[model samples]
Target: MTVLEIEYKTLLNQDEFNRLESRLAHVKPITQTNYYFDTSDFVLKAHRMSLRIRTFSDKAELTLKIPQEVGNVEHNQTLLLPEAKEAIKTAILPNGEIKTLLVQKGIPLEELLVLGHLTTIRRESQTSIGLLALDYNQYAGLKDYELELEVLDAEKGKIDFDNFLEQHNIDFKYAKSKVARFTSTLKKNDQ
Candidate 1:
């Protein structure tokens, strides 16, 4: 399946996450682990793309995200346990639309390699403007929180998000994708 993901992402500290979670106690949270992949030289990152195998409780999915004008265009395919293991072990892009898209973009399948992993505890609630998500993520012995408003309508979503922030008195700032942030950390540690 393909989707156009239109969302605004902002960084949050532990205190903010705690307060937000308390206020959103009615929403149940789900935990998922994302194993990300890229070439040793970071070909996917250079292309502003990402590939990952996301494992939930009973299912796993391989997803590819490519930069788009409005938002990131995502292509996802379901994967069985064996396929997910083999793909991670060999750093091979999964066979399907995601693989085809990568190949079309001139990213050699063989060069793709496992980058790192991150786990997120996510809670979501539906709002008039869009879906609101509070994500607490951990990777590489580091932890952080993020707020995302996945908007169906960009203009309205923006207006709603701004008002939401103002109403909550949140002065948080936006950041790049989780993959990008983890990749940067990996690079810094390597040096």
Candidate 2:
């Protein structure tokens, strides 16, 4: 898939934020939460991306996965194929414009809830994003919260990311896997 997005690197402080708020005029800021889930052995995922176009901001994300799992194999490994649940994304353009897309699935919500076993729940917002994916019974057994920022660029995203972290004195470990792995850690911890 073609990944297309823009990004910005700027820190927001209280005093500067007041000016930003004043500049916003009548536009109201938004924040909300979303609960997501997948299945056993890499069946689910959540993907998000952000962009900046001149004076606007755009973001997109997708979740809901089902992986084919192989069980009872000892001392070896399993090859898994995971199906991405269509794709749902949201974005904002250079003029402070916003857009969103939702996946089409006719399955009854009640049935999906029953079949998927509710392995993940995520609460994402403008300032941050949160995720928890695990076996239903173990969902309440663990609590993990983390902060992250993704700067999209053909080149410079890594450099810019490092600079932002260094300037803020934010200590971070290189992400060893995809961000989706963080969302899947909840389920992995169940074992």
Candidate 3:
């Protein structure tokens, strides 16, 4: 299905977020994760390969990401490092179809004051797999997980997402549909 939406990020210091959440009825700890896979021979020519290290959440997390060439509007796969400041990402196909993958859902305007970093994964153009896990840190935070398979045909296979999870050491009974929903509650509190 085609997807279109905006993503929001709030970068408040612990104290600031606490002060903000205090006014709200409920405040909770949340966890989010994103996994990226590169196609074979992935190369971006716009800039030389460079490395940058970022620290956020008051030494809570750290990440390293690199940037490359300008993106191809057709058949391009892209993802943003969690540290990147509320940025926009899209994938384009050769047939002139465009899609946005990473979007900001809500922006923490009054509480946040930090710069985010961005990075691109590169590999040879081929089929690849990826997954995203969100808000798994808390006891009540539902653990969301999705696996992406670079199948030659989207049809033609009886791929079982649950079975696949079992094979990969994921206990399905503990999994949830979307971790974002719990954060959605946090967003509600933000409102």
* C-alpha TM-scores of all predictions: 0.94, 0.33, 0.24
**Higher-TM-score candidate of 1 and 3:** 1
Question: Least lDDT summed over 10 consecutive residues: which range in candidate 3?
Answer: 91-100
Residue 47 displacement in candidate 1 (angstroms):
1.5
lDDT: worst 10-residue window of model 2: 70-79
| Alpha-carbon RMSD, each predicted model | 1.3, 15.2, 17.3
Q: How close to the true structure is residue 189 of candidate 3, measured as C-alpha lDDT?
A: 58
CA lDDT, every prediction?
Answer: 0.87, 0.29, 0.25
- lDDT value, residue 125 of candidate 1: 96
Full-model lDDT, candidate 3? 0.25
Candidate 1 has its poorest 10 consecutive residues by lDDT at: 86-95
Error of 3 at 34 (Å): 7.4
Query: Distance from true position, residue 133, model 1, in Å?
Result: 0.9
lDDT of 2: 0.29
Top-down TM-score ranking: 1, 2, 3
Error of 2 at 101 (Å): 12
Candidate 3 structure quality by residue, lDDT tens digits, 63-167: 112222321112222333432323212211111111122112122212222211222111111122222111212213332222222332223211443344445
